[model samples]
Target: MNPSNQSPNHTAEDESQAVVTRRIQRLSLHLMAISAQNYDLCIVSCSSRGKLEVDKAQLSRYMRGKHREIQERVFEYFNSRPDLQTPVEILKDDHRELCWRQLLGLVREAGIKPFKYVAEDPAQYFAIAEAVGSVDMSLGIKMGVQYSLWGGSVINLGTKKHRDKYYDGIDNLDYPGCFAMTELHHGSNVQGLQTVATFDPIKDEFIINTPNDGAIKWWIGNAAVHGKFATVFAKLMLPTHDSKGYSDMGVHAFIVPIRDMKTHQTLPGIEIHDCGHKVGLNGVDNGALRFCSVRIPRDNLLNRFGDVSRDGKYTSSLPTINKRFAATLGELVGGRVGLAYSSVGVLKIAATIAIRYSLLRQQFGPPRKPEVSILDYQSQQHKLMPMLASTYAFHFATANLVEKYSEMKKTHDEQLVGDVHALSAGLKSYVTSYTAKSLSVCREACGGHGYAAVNRFGSLRNDHDIFQTFEGDNTVLLQQVAGDLLKQYKEKFQGGPLTVTWNYLRESMNAYLSQPNPVTARWEGEEHLRDPKFQLDAFRYRTSRLLQSVAVRLRKHSKTLGSFGAWNRCLNHLLTLAESHIESVILAKFIEAVQNCPDPSSRAALKLVCDLYALNRIWNDIGTYRNVDYVAPNKAKAIHKLTEYLSFQVRNIAGELIDAFDLPDYVTRAPIARQSDAYAYYTQIVGF
Candidate 1:
């Protein structure tokens, strides 16, 4: 917009904020020149007049060069694939079969197989798949089910024999598979499943059976038509010498061939039925299966941690039954981590659509003057800017998660594994929950136009809604995170420099114990918001206070209700505590990213985003902060104003901030957000 057309009410603060935006862009080239190791420490002195030195060359790379290449490849892959271009807005069972097969062919042509990623790096490959999700989450989920779930299980839970046997076909989509862990009677409670795998010594085989109707596997993706095999989770039933029973052995996975590859018919004793149309992502062939004594070779079991001897003895490398259970559960983190990564991908699409539309869309205006873009409106700014900030926050958090998981997968470090499990659980729940709320906001921000599928907002929303429940239910996952935090608190886990959660806890404890008046020493307003340590302290204090409150409540109630009863009663509060801890983790990552940018301009821009994230979160929970005496009413007011200031700072840089995400026009495809003149193309199509 022309500066002359600005409202007379526009003030000095708005102009200064605009300068901050330009100043941030100025350092981008210098930042790009800095080595990755020293990028974080890139600090430059202000000129005598306090103006930033502007450089036109592109220096700062928002993402790693390789990852940026990966993102562009995803956009290119979708745009160039004619098979995938067909609108899947609607499809019947038969059409879905064709769509699924077409999807397989397109992926093959793109060379985006799950096995290719598995061979390179499990964690990194999963992250890249998530990046691909911004275009089509259904395909992402289908691939996730094949590679991340089915292929993931083989790699993580199975031995070399299983990997060598299935990896080739899985990556090539030759031996398509389904992961059937969720039963009709059980979604979150795996141990409660009643499917039994009985050992038949005479036949030297394991008979997989559904003991009752409730044991049937429900929502098994790729089972309706595409999948020929399934990774089945069932109770390992063994003959007892005395009063011991089969349920005593717990759950184990078996490689069950569901359908005959040639006939495309269900194996004898296995009843399969389609789950039918879902709220969204109908492209996946989800089905249910009931096994009536379906027998398979004993060697079909994916034996890495556990095995059955020739003499019919069951033994495991894991120390205890719980450890065995946890080992299996731990391998599933790849999916959760990918879900979190994909949640950010989804958020980027929503923000891009909303922000670009608002910029071009003009509405009511001053008398005898040109109408203003909706983006100039405070309401639109308030709605879209914070969501944009959050998408960036999730991006950094996911990158951190990917690195941690990759490191853990390589070294098999127990501490890193435990941390990854705990982190993925909380991050997945938190990121998906935020994405759901933010996507709705983005949709509503676009007015009635957003409701139409052609705009892509409605479909994106529908497809992503399942993310809250799938992989793992967000609510149940948060509870597990709470349980983990409580365990960490009780154990008082020690933290070194790199240990995230425990390190935050340790700092909080030190502040409460060592510092007589930590709050008194705190800087006011922008100074406090800009300090990385201050943000960490704010997050840590809130988390610690909530954790302490939970401990007290549990202690008080447990005497009468018992530990289980107390825990059940306090689940809601525990969820909040976990939420606060996760917010802290996110803030810490954003801070790290902010501190590490070597270019002054780039660092300045990122700080604005990080500050906005921290301030907005703290503002939302101002009541909680006040209740704990963490912030005075006056201090809270300053924090609120700082959020507004940060919002304006972001407003000036909003276009460039999204440009940093680098989504091409081809992938977005919305006429309103087209790379060419969006208004001209839109008017040409609609004749408006």
Candidate 2:
């Protein structure tokens, strides 16, 4: 980054350092993977199959079929129209308000109505919503805030009366709505909100009041210029029988109109203003709002779980206060799951751009030889191929999550709700964290041209940065997942059977306990690397051991700290547990996807991506192979070598692998990725 280091020769200098740095770093890990005995677990390296050309024809149909077909149609339709293209183009231009309005109008026109699709085919509906993120997170988020957040509240929490009033219009995007939840002082801590909705007996209405500056709704999409209403989350101030104002009935959702539909103006008591320019999602028109004793009909409460009567009496069918709160929250998991799943699509776009650019961008090679594609370097492959592998991993994991969510909607099972919440929270945090890193890596992978706006990596890097914080902050979501996981672990300790699927924690615990003493851990080499069962054994064993260690740590911490304090102290360890579980889930789900694949060619290609994912993760966290002797330390070194070997294997098919994402030029929108046209494209655009 030194100014004097900004010459063409410096590029090769930096690339050399990067390659050497990776070697030094891995050599350090190599020792960690080798125990005092230097035990190693690498068989024949990548000898399972001879150089098989990646099945490009099958890969073209890799992510195809009905859902992809559906996505393509929607993408083509929404992307084709002149007006719709204008909003995306205007995203980088001035007049942020105009861009958001254009987005809202086009969301309606494109029939990206989340509420409409949720009632019929929810997965497809969610898919279309996610497909939007692949193109532009700004527009996707605007559309999602309206239908998924605002209208989703009505569908999930409201009875027939509320649905009849809002569902039809919400479906067609006739009304733009926002989910008013986070306050200036409260975001992840929904329970700490200061906004109060007091029951007024005189008018039989609820008075929504923002008592202080901190209580003002902040970062609300659609409120700046477009939304007419919001599904507001606030404390319910219900009077007790003793006439005391408010009970501890907790936070609830209420339908509050913020703007006059025709005028698009803030209502009398609703103070609204734009949040001004932000780092990304510029077209979202984010704004803040403060309510001053705004009154709405008592029925405005989305009262499927809790309600107030004409006499201002609070009521609910949920057996316990906890049940009522959980049920209400159950209605909102879709947002988390949607974001988690949607991240996969976004990651795909990023991976496509980075990989394509790497393949096209060449650098120093052997003396007197032609320059090599950057991807041909082990250092460059290390940067992008793993991210590509994770994109595939998340793709299957999130797909399964979407189906589980649909089942939860149908059955309304509390058990499923709890599990889904945990899974989605973990996946959302892990995937987005991975994605944020991927965008930056992708941007850097392209070197200088990556910073160019026309290549799309710059906007993508900026836009994806916020995705880590929203939906739910990554750290908070991971903590929640960790907490949920620990609860299950505790239940198992109390003699209750553990109930996790595929990546079975209980069975893993039993296996680890039975083999407390290490056997001569002989890794049969590269052939064993191709065994999904062998990979799962390593992953599952690590997760089980980490969970056990974390449990012990928490128990020990409890002796000195209060429950919350003990938990707070163990947050980092808990995150480790959550991450371990997530990595296992990603691996298990990917293996399953390939095993269940009917197409031999596609399966063969996906198998390489899957192996790369597993090996790459194990290599990076080589210490996972340490601590417990279930796997030998040298096996970790083997994993590192195998990952490098798998990287080469994946590199052979990198184009087809990315091509499987099916991102057309319009979707990728990166000039460098245009291969033969890169020079002409950047020349004309950059006026070089």
**Candidate 1 clashing pairs?**
28-60, 29-59, 32-59, 32-60, 39-596, 39-598, 40-596, 42-598
- Index of the highest-TM-score prediction: 2
lDDT of 1 by residue, 1-688 (tens): 6888889988779989988988888777455455333322321211122332322123226544346656566667767765566473557565466556555764677665556665467655765676666666677788788888898888888998888788888878888899999999899899888899999878889999998889999999999988999999998888766776453577889999999989988889999999988887777789999999899998888788788876679889897778898998987788888889888888888898888888878997554557778876667878988888888888889888988887887898888988999899999999999998988898899898777667788888888999899888999999988988877777664433334556656545656434335364344667766677766787788888788789899999999999999999998999998899899999989988878767777777778788888888888888977776677767788888778766766766677777666677777767777756986776666667
Clash number by candidate, in order = 8, 7
TM-score of each: 0.88, 0.90
lDDT of candidate 2 over 533-604, digit per residue (tens): 878777777777777888888889899897788888888888888888888888888999898877787888
**Residue range with the least summed lDDT across 10 consecutive positions in model 1:** 40-49
User: For model 1, how big is the CA root-mean-square deviation?
Assistant: 11.0
Q: Worst lDDT window (10 residues) for model 2?
A: 35-44
lDDT of 1: 0.79
lDDT of 2 at 490: 78
lDDT of 2: 0.79
